[model samples]
Target: MNWYVVYTKPKWEKKVAEQLKKSGIECYCPLITVMRQWSDRKKKVEVPLFNSFVFVQLPDSDRNLVFQSVGVVRYLFWLGKPAIVRDEEIKIIKKGLDGTDSCEITIVPFQIGDKIALDSGPFSTQTAIVQEVNNTHYVLVLESLGCVLKMKYK
Candidate 1:
């Protein structure tokens, strides 16, 4: 048996995985937890590592059952052909899932309560309080300006 990508309906990867599992197909969908803040409270949500795609370990004979299943978009390749994913990559991903490495660390975003020191830039070697953490940048309250400034970190 080999691993193949199964294209799922929009935002239905988990549901498709469930259905495929019920049909005796082995499915793997790795997820990572992210903190989502709401008006009243903050919650940790498990989001898919890949969007709209679920990997399945199936042979050619069982591929038909998944292809005919509802909520599956396709075999995740051009013209419905099975796309090949390198076994080494799958093994690495599986190793990550198995906690073989240090991939299970919770990366807490630099939030208001957390302290951060600038590694470079005009604020290099300076410590700043995290006012907000946004996509592609971090809004920091510089001690010199008494105002918030956005800084990009790789």
Candidate 2:
């Protein structure tokens, strides 16, 4: 079996990972705990280390099974081929997320329209879809009322 990256629908990483495991597929979805603030209180929440992506261990023969899994969009391709994730790289990711490595957390490249919550700040726990990303900051829109929030993290 080889490690492959599966791209999932927005915010579906955790659900997809659980579904894959329930289907007897070997998979890894790294998560990190971060402080979330609400107007009333603060709490720790688990978020995907890499948004919308899950790592699965399977042979080429099982590709169809993964495709049929819930929330799976497609396999990530590079250079016109399926990108194979190395075992060592997976280990590194685990270590990094585990805080056993120099980096404490991993932030995947996020796209506009991506759903996210503020990890640390006065406005935490506010779930919003990304409308813009400019370097370390983001413009997010609260879906219900179309309110906008601009946040920056160092």
Candidate 3:
């Protein structure tokens, strides 16, 4: 079996993954919990590691079943064919996000000006740009709101 990436409706990755699992399809939607602050208090919430993407481990015969799930947009394809992802790569993602509370622990490569999103807290689903970088800390510039946030990353 090969792992394939399916694009889901915005903010629907977890729901689609759950529905796929109920139908006996093997699905993996990596998530991370991040601390979010509101005026009242602080809380931790789970969010998708990759927005709008869910990984399904399936054979070619089961491809259509994934499409039947609610909120699935389509398979991510390359050259008109579904792209195949390796088992090891899936393992890496699973292990990385398993118990993390901060995004800084991730080694996923990013460069200046790269846009990323806040998955939890008051800024849930907000997009921001990477304006600076370092091993332990960095700066994120939220352009739409005209705010600059300094965050720790390690």
Candidate 4:
């Protein structure tokens, strides 16, 4: 089996994967976990690492089947030709997927005093001081509010 890249319609990765499976194409789509907060509550969610693409393992004879499949835009290309992914890179990705719980969230590294653009909450777009850092989250003090908020970065 050879690995090929399949580009999908915007936000259609999962749908395309399902269709590909029914057509007997083996595929992989890595996901990252995120913490989502709403007005009344907070919960964990998983999102794709690459927004609208998936890797599929298929033979050359069935390659056309993929091109004709619904939700598939085309194989990833360069110089007007289908591009090939290196075996080593695919192996590395497979290793990471095999080793970790894909839903395990992690933090973005922050150095002390680093100026950060707030990504969410009431202070969105404001600058804050990175007071502390930990796995999957960080502590930022909103100077004007005199309150420190814990935020998930990954």
The top-ranked prediction according to lDDT is 3
Candidate 2 TM-score versus the reference: 0.63
Query: Global lDDT of each model?
Result: 0.80, 0.87, 0.90, 0.81
For residue 110, give model 3's deviation from the true position in Å: 20
Q: Is candidate 1 or candidate 4 better by TM-score?
A: 1
Candidate 2: where are CA atoms >4 Å away? 100-154
Output the worst ten-in-a-row residue range by lDDT, candidate 3: 98-107
Q: Is candidate 1 or candidate 3 better by TM-score?
A: 3
Model 3 score (lDDT): 0.90
Question: Model 3, range 48-148, lDDT digits (tens) per residue?
Answer: 98999999998998799987888999999999999899999998887766656446555676689999988977777899999998887778898888999
Candidate 2, residues 1-154, lDDT tens digits: the string is 7899999999999999999999999999999899999999999999998888999999898887987777999999999988899999998888777765454477787689898876766666677899998888988898765689877766
Q: How would you order the candidates by lDDT, starting with the best?
A: 3, 2, 4, 1
N/CA/C clash count, model 1: 0
- Measured against the true structure, the TM-scores of the candidates, in listed sequence, are 0.61, 0.63, 0.63, 0.60
